[model samples]
Every structure is written in structure tokens, then in C-alpha cells.
Target: MYSKFLILLLLSAFCTSCGSKPETTRPVTGTITESVYASGVIKGENQYQVYSTVNGLVEKVLVSEGDLVKKGTPVIQLVGKVAMLNTENAGLAAAYSRISANGERLSELENNISLARQKMNNDASLFERQKNLWDQKIGTRLEYEQRELAYSNAVNAFETAKLRYNEALKQLRFQEQQSQKNLQILQTSAKDYIIKSESEGQVYDILKKAGEMVTPQTAIAIIGDASRFLIELQIDEYDIAKIKIGQKILVNMDSYRGTTFEAKVSRVIPYMNERSKSFTIEAVFVKAPQTLYPNLTCEANIVISHKEKALTIPRDYLLDGGYVLLQKEKKQKVSTGLMDYQRVEILGGLKGDENLIKPQ
Candidate 1:
């Protein structure tokens, strides 16, 4: 009986000692760096859908997929009646000068005027000499009359030649203006025969094949420099307030396994979509990989609120808002502050050394 009594006494002492010692629990401490995580898909900085501005049958494709193209580079050629008509009209107008040459015609008119003036000068000389003789009574009236008549005929011929030269100048100017107008029309028509790139980029897709009929609004090929990447994430409405612009973020891509990337919140859109009950958030990577492709799936974490030295407790220990069983003895209500998904801030009713915790 004494041995049994001693054993009971020893066990009692051990129990008392164990109860007096501080209990081991899961540590609940304030987090210095708060974070929120989300998953989304990677996208390009700019996307383009190329289309044709003129309607025709696709004749030729100058670029294939992955080909680098410059602004205003020809992408495709359209074959149709309109293209043929433009080529024919330009040829006809360019060759129109062959039928009637204005410069040659002008030269001919000038030569005729020169001959007429020479005849007028010769006749005048004869008429002057006769007039002088008539004044001196040394020439007969019939001879003077014949010379004057000849001079009058030469003057009429010279006047007619001058009029013809002026008409030729007018015709030459009119023909030059007409030719320029026709040339402009032909140039405009030629532009419709080919589609050109509006931006410098890589051809990502070819929507139309050669010999396919297309319209002005037809999307032919997509060309864009999709090298740089960004992420578009949809955040829930309940968590929108915790997110802000310029917040630091962490990213993980499905393609890059066991590798993580960093990014920042560039924009936090204010409006929430009714269908999604979420807001769109955009982020840019800090150091993007060269192999990052567009439409790649990615996850993001946006750090929100952080605390370092404040009182905190495990989330599972609390019975309700601001309520917890202290040291397995008494229940007390307390005020709280900032909360995370794992822990809650204990603002009042608990000391740092006080035992108010539970098992993990």
C-alpha cells in the first residue's frame, strides 16, 4: 500500500509540473508582407487583326506565318476585272501622247509663222521702194498699186499664222493637264489591287487564301509584335478593395514549372462586371522570359496589408468574432484589427505572455 501511495504521489507531482509548464502551440504572428493570389492567362501587349480595305479576289500572298513585315509593306495582291482595267487605263493614257504630240504640233505652227513673216518683210521692202519712186514721179501708178496689194496679202498671211500659233499653245496646255488627271486616277486604282500592312509586326495568321473572293471589311492576316507579355486577371468583388495599383505581385506559369516570376499591379479597374461579379486587373512582369508566349496560363498574388509586431492569434482558436477560450479556463470577448486568411489580429484582452491558444 505504501508503494502504491508513493506511485500516486509521484504521478500527481508529474501532472502538476506538466500543467504548470507553458503549452507548445502553433505560432501565430503578424505577417510583415501581405499577399493575395490569383490565376489568369498571359496576353500580348498589342493584338491586331489585319483586314483588306478594297474588295477583290486574293491573287498573291507576299508574307507567310512568322514573317517580319514593315509598315506599308505589300501583303497581298488582288486579281479581278478592276485590277486589269486599271492597268489598261494607265497604259492607254500614258500612250495617248503618241497619237497627237503637242510639242511637235507647236513647232510646226511656229515654222509656218516664220515663213509668213519673211514674206511680209520682202513685200514691204518692195512696196517701200515703189512708194519712194511714186513720191518722186519716177514710178508708174500701176507698179505702186501692184506692190501695195502684194504687201497687203503678205500682212494677212502673217496675222493668220500668229493666230494658229496661239491656238496651238492653248491646246498643248490643255493636253498636259488632262494627262496628269488620268495618271492620278490610274494610281488610285492600282492601290486597290494590293493590300498593305498598316503596322510593323510579325504575321501571325493568314485568314484568306489565294484566289478567294474578299470584301473591303475582310480580315486577311493578323500582324503584331507579340514578344512582350502582360497578364489579365479577374479579381472577385469581395476582395477588390484590398487590391490597389502599384502593389507588388508574384506569378507562376504552367509552362515554366517550379519557376516563379515577379510583377506589379499596373491598373485595378474600379467597375465590377455584373456577369462575373469581378473586376479586371492588369499586371506587367518585372523580368519576363524570352520564351514567354501569348495566351499562356499564369497565377498572380497581390500583397495587400502587412503587420510586423502586433498581437495576433490562430484563426482556428477563435469561437466567433473577438471571442476565444483563454488558457482552457475562461472565455473572454476581445477587439480585433487587421485579419488574414490564416490569422487575426488580437487588439485587446490578451497580453504577450498570457496563455490564450489551442492545438493545431
Candidate 2:
């Protein structure tokens, strides 16, 4: 009797413990995504820092901040007296070569040519009369020889005058063309003194004031196509390789707090920034926000992979060797696929209905 009672008590205690064991949650099907974190800024299409091409004093600023301008619109005027003077001198030289070249010097050559022809005519007549006299034996040989020598000298003089005229005309014409070319070069240089917008946009800011000495490297203003905007991202070197053009980006902007926007990577600048150790990426809005401004701070997640329905569990529930604790403290290994910060996808070795224990 005593042995039977001891056996009953042990059996009742074991059954109570089994009946009171805690329940566990089952794995559920859900969406999972793998992504990389990135930070960036909003910018307009063709956005850029404006700079002058020449170093000079800012003579005048033509456009104010937020002023709308057209392409080829003058933004800043620089003072360059030397450039203007060079243009003026070139113009004067071109005019001299074209107009004054045919003026006095050419006229003198023309007159000289005419005079030489007339003298040659007179000398030829004398020479012919003397030759006839000699042939008839009516004059001394010395007289005929002297007339022939005079005619030869006249012919040489006329030819020399004609050659000189042609040479002078060529020289003057060449000078005119060269001077005109020099004028054009000087005019182009003068244009550098006036900074113009390359695209139509509003001036975001002006960095120079009147009387300030500015260099070609100095920023004068900011401009872009205001109606269009894109995101400029600076991704760390380690993450750049995984990023590619056309990747979907999940964006969060500082300006638009609590709101998430969507964008697609448009460009990935190939070279790494040696100093910053980062790479640049460009993205355009898929469904842009209602509005955007230049240089707005933003954060983005470059999606690498995603699944609409996946077997997922809290990342903390996964242990070393890809094992998961199940009901009754059972352990099973699982293969993982896409994973994010909070959860990981189980590709195999687990079913959706299996109860999983919350990690202690």
C-alpha cells in the first residue's frame, strides 16, 4: 500500500507540470526587405554653383537672390579695363587695315604706275624713230644705241612699279584680315568680364558684392531648374559597390518630417572621393513630394532585395549556427535569405505554423 501511494503522487505531479507549460507564437508569413542606409540632399536639375571665368572686381550684380533669369542672362558684371581697351585697339587696327590701307600709300603707287607707262610710251616712240634713221644710214650708231638703252630702262621701271603696287596691296589686305581676327578674339575675352547664366533658373544666393575682388574659382551664385529636383547622395565607400543605377531608394527628408518619399537611383558617380572616402549618387523622385527645395537634407535606404510574403521572425530569435528555439525548448537550424535590422527571412528548415519561443 505505501509503495502504490508514492507512485501515484509522482505521476500526479508530473502530469500537472506538463499541463501548465507556456504557449509559444507561431511563425507567420510576411514581407521582408534587405536594404542599405544612406544619407543625401535634395537638389534641382542642373543645379550648380555659379562662378566667373575671369578674375576681377565685381563691378555690378545684375540679379538679386530669388530673381528669375533666362539662359544667356547677365548675372554679374566684372570690371576689366584692360580687356575693353584691347578690344578697342583691335577694332582700330582692323579699320586701318581695311579703309586707310587703300588711302594715301595705294594712291601714290597707282600714280607712279601710270607715270611709268606714259614715259615708256614716249621712250618707245623715240627709240623707233632712231632705229629707222639708223637702218637708212641717216644717223650715227651711237644715237640709236642711246635711244634703245633709254627704252629698256623705261620698261624695267614700269615693271618694277607694277610689282611694288601688287606687293603693297597684298600686304594691306593681309593686315586687314589679321586685324579683324584679332578683334574677334579680344571681343570674346571681353565677354568673360560679364558673367552669364548657362541655364534658366532663379538665383538662390549671391556670394559676391560690388568692389569685392573675385577669382575665376570663386562662387558668384547658385542656379538651377527650379521646377525639377533630384536627390544627391553621398554613400560610404564600403556601401558603394552594392549600390547601382536604377535601384529603388526609400527616402526620408529632414525638411519633411515624419514623411517618407520614394526615389530611384539615376546615377552613381564612378570615382571615389579620395578626401571624403565616399561616392556620389543621384536619384530622381518616382512619386515626388508636393514640393522640394535645393539642398534639403535627406536619408535613404537603397533596397537590395525584398519579398512580399516570407517566413520571418525577430532577428533576436535567431541564434548562432542559424538555430531557432521552438515549443518545448526544441532547437532547429534554419536557412536565412533577405534580412533587415529587426527581422530575418527563413528560407528553409522551418514551417509557418511551427510555434517559436520568445528568446529569454
Candidate 3:
């Protein structure tokens, strides 16, 4: 009986100790800044992947990885033997389509025109002589009439020959023009085989080496503005609505340890990434470092709002979404406002002297 009594006494003592234990803090006026976190890579302004435009062996690479180049400067050259052959063939076709005296077809037409003209002149002279004879009654009427008919037929033949000659010439000219246009197209395609920079910038990398087979889809190199840079960040969709252009950002990078950089949002890409469920954003440095390279990973905290002094409490002290633990284990409902990752603002039902317990 004495042992049972001792066990009951110990149980009661344990329950009392559990009820008496307390961890508490009073609501205080303090600052809170709401920010959205993002991760991104540092990239040069206008940075882009350069691609080859023809399928061939890379004959040469004119620029190195770090070479600064101007727009339209040649960066890579392909073998282009096929393109060159095609262009030359087109040029020859254009040149040959132009008809000249040496062309048998054209010579035939010229001969017909000359022969018809000679016949016309002869018939006209004969008709004139015959008409004069008929007028003086020295020639038969039948003979004069036949001569006039011959003259008229000869004139018609001459006119027809001239028209045929002109049409043939016109056809030849049309053919020549078509050939010339085809040659121009071929030449342009051949020129494309020599990959050129689209913008003035430094080459970040050369993906294809000399003698490597490359196609139009193959990346030849990367280039971008060497003196300027911008940040490409991916922000969570949940936080993107609050992100706006011109908002200040606090940037941190592994490359620059123990340092933070200032930046501002320059653009917000509205499209969401299907894979990451995030939106892409662009920012420019307010005071960039002395130097930066392309593709450097960085982290940023986009400032959404800030309060100078507000009724705040440690985030850990809150109980669930709408309440806090009060004295004597009573649940107190407090109206909450802006919150950071570590603290929450109490809009109502909490005061500076009232104790809010941190649940253990």
C-alpha cells in the first residue's frame, strides 16, 4: 500500500512540472522587410549561342574564346566546297543564257530576218517596174497584178520575221534574268557558310574545333557584350506577382564570397517554365563589380516591402496560422500582417507587455 501511494505521488509531480515549464516573449516594435528569393546566373548583355549555318567540316576558327569581335565579323569558316560549286554553276548558267551571234539558234533567226528583208526589197522593185510598164500599156495586166501580190506577200513575210526575231530575243533576255537571280541566291547561301558574329561582343567559348563536322543546328560558339552584364533569374511563381520592374534586389554570389551587390529588376518574363514552375526575370547591377563573366551563378533577394517599426514577434512564437500561445496555456487569436522568414507583424490582439509563449 505504501509503494502504490509513492507511485501516485510521483505521477502528480511529473504532471505539475510539465504544466509549469514556459518559454515566452513580448511583442515589440521593430523593422521587417518582405523579400522574395531567387536563383540565377550572371550573363553578359545580349549573350547568345552562335550556331553554324551549313553542314560541313569546320575549315577554320578565326576567333579565340576571349576574342572581342564586331558584328558581321567572320568567326568560323566551313569547308564550303559544295556551296562554292553550286554558286559557280549558277553563275555559269546565267552567263550562258545570254544569247549572242555565236549561238546557232540566234544566228538562224538573224538569217531569216535578213533573207526576208532582201526578198521584200526585190519584190518592191519588181512591182514598181511592172506598174510603170502597165501604165504605159507595155506589160500584161496579169503580170502587173501578180507582181503587186508578190510585193504584198514579201512585206508580210518581212514583218513576221522581224516580230519572231524580237520575241526570241525577249525570251533569251528573260532566261538570262532568271539565271542571274538564281545565281544571286546561290551566292548568298554560300556566304552563309562562313559564320559571322551577329553582334559586337567577346566570344565566350568555341564549341566546334577545326576539322570537326558541323551542321546548321550545331553551336559554333557563344558571344555577348563584353563590357556590360545582366542577371537572369528564375523566381517562383508564388512570389512572381509581387515582383515588379525597378524593385531593388540584394544579390549574392559564390564567386564573390562575403560580399553583396545591389541591383534592380529590369524585366519580368511573363511566361512560366513548365519544368520548374517559375518565371524568368532580368536585372541589371546598380553598382556591378569591377568584372564579371558569363554564366556565373548568383542568388538574389528581391525586396517587396519594408516597415520601419511595427508590432512584431518571433515567427516561432506563433501557434498555427491564426493564433499564439498565451499565459496559462490559453490560445490567443492575433491579427497578423507583413511577415519575413524569421518574424511576423502583429496587427491586433497582441501588445508590448503581453507575453506570447513559444511552443516547445
Candidate 4:
């Protein structure tokens, strides 16, 4: 009888302890997402380093660092003494004058050709009259031969005159071409003295100072459009597969304390860094702050996957190996697809109406 009473007490204690475990709440309907958190730096899209295209002394620096500039604005002025001197000493003026003189000479050649044509016509009339007299047997053949020789000489002179006229036209064309080419060189020299901006942007740096001798390809200034900015982040090798273009992102910059901005993934670089074993990704802000600056450090959360209006449970309920104890009754094994830092996506094995529990 004593042994039976001990067994009954132990059984009752075991049942009471089983009933004492607390109940856990399951999420009913909300969006569940998988995300990755990372750090990044802000940069502009239109950043470029400006360089000079001609060798000269920097006569003036019209823009200082941090000055806003527009397209075609003169950022620097250079004086090319050799180039200017060459232009002044060259035969450009003489070439233009020669082209004008060639035009007048071509007109004179045309007049000479007209006079040769008139002489040829008169000689041909005389030769035809002498031919008619010889055919009628009333004039000597020598007279006809002399008139024919005169006509032939007239024809030769006319042909020579036409050839000279055509030659003069060709010379005129050649002179025009030479003059135009020279004028173009002079125009280029005038424009080369001024260094113009290629785009509308802010001047971020000035590499050359006034009176500095700069050659073609020497960096003059750094300019970029500051209005557009993006965050460049590196994803670890383990988490790179979870990032994709067009993913929604939450960004927080260290400069904007306690504030966050919405952004979207714009690019995912295909290649990975061999040394760091990471891949780079870029995100563009949906609502950018007015005070954003380049190289600003930012933290980003990349949302990889999502579930809409589905059942979810607190992440703490997951046990070792992603198993969960449900209502302290059954061990539910779930297949996960995506997860945030706290919550994970349940792919299968859990019914929408099942109960969940938190492990102590």
C-alpha cells in the first residue's frame, strides 16, 4: 500500500508540471520579409576628373573648389604663346588674299577663252569660202590649204585657251580649300585658350593653379553632379545570394542621427572580390535628404523575400535546428526560405491555424 501511494503522487506531480507550461501567441496576418543588414558609403553618379587638352600656362582659375558650374562655363583660361605666335606668323592672311586673286584670274581666263572662240569662228568662215572656190575650179589649191592651216591654228589656240581656263578654275578651288583649312586652324586656336566645362556640376577640386604649366591630359579639376547620390555596400560571401536588384531597402546614415530613409537596390555587381570574398551592391534613395554628402557612411537592410498576409510566429520560438514546440504538445519542423535578423520565413510543414510556443 505504501508503494502504490508513492507512484500515484509522482504521477500527479508529473501531470501538473506538464500543464504549467505557458501558452504562446501566433502572428495572424502580416507581411514577413527576409533581409540583410550591411554598411556602405555614399557616392555620386556623375563624378569625373577634368583634364586640359592643350599645353599652355594657366593664366586664370575662374572657379575654385566647391563652386557650382554650368556646361560651357570657363573654368580655367590658358595662354598659349607658341600657338598664338604660330598663328600670327603663318601665311593665313596671304592664303586668303591668294584665293581672292585666283577668283579674278579665273574671270580673265574665261574672257581669253571667249576671244579665242571668236577668232576660231572667223578663220573657219574664211576656210569654207576658200574650199568652195577650189571646188568650183576657179581658185588655186594652195589658197585653200593656207586657209585650212589658219583654221587649224585657230582651233589649236582655242583648245589651249580652254585648257588654261579649266586649269585656272582648279587653282581657284585649291586656294579656297587651303584658305578654309587655315581659317579653321585660327578658330581652333582662339577657342583653345579657354577651357570650358563639359557638363553642369559642382567643382570639387582644383589640381592646377594660375601660372602653372599644364600639358594636354593634365588634370585640371574634379566635378560631379551632387544632387544624385547612392550607397555602395558590400555583401558578405555567405549573404550575397540573398541580395538582388530592385529589392526594397531601409537606409540609415550616421550623419542623420535617429533618422532613416527608404531606398531600393539599383545594381548588384556580378563579380566578387577575391581578397575580401565579398560582392558590391548599389542602392538609390527613394526619398533623399537635402543635406546628404558624398562618402557618408550608411547602414542598409536589403529585403530579399516577403510574405503578405500570412501566418507568422515570433522568432524566439524556433528551437535548435529550426524546430519549434507548438502549444507544448507537438514538435513542428518548418522549412524556411527567407528571414530577417529576428524572424524567419516558414516555407512548409506548419498549418496556418497551428499553435506556437516560446522555449524557456
Clash count per candidate: 0, 0, 0, 0
> Which candidate number maximizes lDDT?
3
- lDDT string, candidate 3, 1-360, tens digits: 999999999999999998895778888898999899999999999999998766889899999989999999999998888889999999889888977632888788889999999999999999999999999999789999999999999999999998998898899989988998999999999998899999999999999999999987878899999899999999999999999999999999999999999999999999999999999999999999997989999999999989999999999998886899888888989999888899998889876789778898
Q: TM-score, each model? A: 0.56, 0.81, 0.87, 0.67
Candidate lDDT values, in order = 0.78, 0.90, 0.92, 0.81
**Candidate 2 stretches greater than 4 Å from native:** 1-28, 313-335, 349-360
How big is the positional error of residue 77 in model 4, measured in Å on the Cα after superposition? Answer: 2.6
The numbered model that scores best in TM-score is 3
How far out, in Å, is residue 27 in model 1? 16
For model 1 the local lDDT of residue 236 reads 86
Question: What ordering of candidates by lDDT runs from best to worst?
Answer: 3, 2, 4, 1
- Model 1 lDDT at residue 76: 86
The alpha-carbon lDDT assigned to residue 8 of candidate 4 equals: 100
Model 4 ranges off by over 4 Å: 1-33, 37-40, 44-46, 54-57, 85-99, 189-193, 211-219, 226-246, 266-282, 306-334, 341-360
Q: Across residues 1-360, which tens digit of lDDT does each residue of candidate 2 receive?
A: 999999999999999987875546667789888998988888889888888878899999999988888999999999989999999999988988894756899999989999999999999999999999999998999999999999999999999999999999989989999999999999999999999999898787898999999897889889988688989999999988889788999999877899888899999889999999999999999999987788889999999888999988888888889999987788998999989999999999897888888666
Better of 2 and 3 by lDDT: 3
